[model samples]
Target: MDLFPPDKILVDRVKNGDREAFTTLMERYQQKVFQTSMGFLHNQADAEDLTQEVFIKSYKSMKSFRGESSFGTWIYRITVNKAINQLRRNKLRAFAGLDAMKGEDSAADTNADAPLLRKEQKEQIKDALTKLNNAQKKVFVLFYYQELNLKEVAEVLELSPKATESLLFRARKNLQKELD
Candidate 1:
């Protein structure tokens, strides 16, 4: 017998009020959801918080899941929406000067400068991602960070494969321009 049940079976169990089944589902996708959230927010704590939010929202709405797409795709859609909203909230806080009051952490880095360089590069990439349009950002994040193939990205974004490819191309071009 297979040690793991399929997601469809698990979804059915959850619909029947099996909380352990829902927990199993969460274990299956939590890391992917966290990576998706991190790709958008670029902050660990924010990503973790968003991951919890995604699972909570998923649990609440599991009954409404039409299974039109795969369970992973459905959860990814939720993560993307929540992460984007969080980014918008952060932007609003910055625009209102509230972010400034939070202040930066001044942890002493006794290590070498290599980590600093990598951190700077990571920040640059994050900024470049932010410059992308919403569609392009979604494509880039799903394809690269979440490691979804073009077809999977398309399914998540509800775009044709050709459209997803074009958006990905434009996103790469724009990101190259931004980084340069």
Candidate 2:
């Protein structure tokens, strides 16, 4: 039988002395983690750094993984929280340079100005996103950027569907106000 085990089993092993289990976990989710970070930070370098940081932080706190949620959901929460922290630590990073970032990780976006958006609009959107408190930003990123459904977002955030729905509503309202 394959002794490699699954994510939950890896978590169990990690809680024990099997450090390789964590490596397995990292290998499984590194890309997803990096992409999520990219969505939040919009910079490949920052996203890569944050992905490593998330795994390291998870290693330190592996004991807390109680299997209440899927390992992906658990790690996503960690990723979101760490990305928020990165945003807080460097609020000076401007989204005005989003064109540069877009080139670095071009994936064929359908935005009106995907190749080169108006700097002012990018700045306005970034400013609006930043103005959202942590809660709103989390919901906005997960739903809009990550394209997660309401139930999945609620699962990751550990909130009821109704609460998550309320968050999305408020986030839309707040973002519309900012863009207007």
Candidate 3:
């Protein structure tokens, strides 16, 4: 009935400085962390870097593990925090592009007739996603891209499951509206 071998045993091994146990933990969760970060940041390179940072930070703080939550949950918290921070920084950069009107003009001219094509439709979807508010974007990414069930998304977002569902519903509705 145990999905994890034993948290206490693994924790003790890690505390006693067992590098292999740490590697096992990292291997088990690295992909999940990277996927979750990519869902938030929407960039492969940045997500990969954030995933490494999350594992390092988790390992450094593992000695304080009190067994109150699963190790998975603790690491998930770190991944979410780092990913959110990265997204905010990226948003700032995108907004700062407003200063370069010539750059915006050039992009618009290059894509002048793009809206008439299928490839442009995909680009429209990407643009609509970027337009979503932060909370809506977070809920949408977690629900869809991360493939988290509603309950897990609720836990990560610190919302009641009902509230999480509502958020997801709203996010989808907004995305649909934007795409339309």
Give per-model CA RMSD. 2.6, 4.9, 5.4
Q: How far in Å is the alpha carbon of 13 misplaced in model 3?
A: 2.3
Model 1, 8-124: lDDT tens per residue? 889989999999999999999999999998788776777899999999999999999988888999999999888888988988998999877442421112223547777677667
TM-score of each: 0.90, 0.75, 0.77
For each candidate, the alpha-carbon lDDT, in order, equals 0.86, 0.82, 0.76
Backbone clashes, each candidate: 0, 0, 0
Q: How well is each residue in 1-180 modelled by candidate 2, as lDDT tens digits?
A: 557688888888889979988888899989888888876776667789999999989999888889888988999999998998888666544355535554434333324454455655675676788788888788888888678899999999989999999999999999899999
**Model 2: residues with Cα > 4 Å off, grouped in runs:** 92-117
lDDT score of residue 6 within candidate 1: 96
Which candidate's TM-score is highest? 1
Query: Comparing 2 and 3 by lDDT, which wins?
Result: 2
Could you give candidate 3's per-residue lDDT for residues 68-95 as a string of tens digits?
7778777887887787787677667768
Structure candidate 1, residue pairs in collision: none
lDDT measured at residue 67 in model 3 versus the true structure, 0 to 100: 70
In candidate 2, position 152 carries an lDDT of 98
Candidate 2 backbone clash number:
0
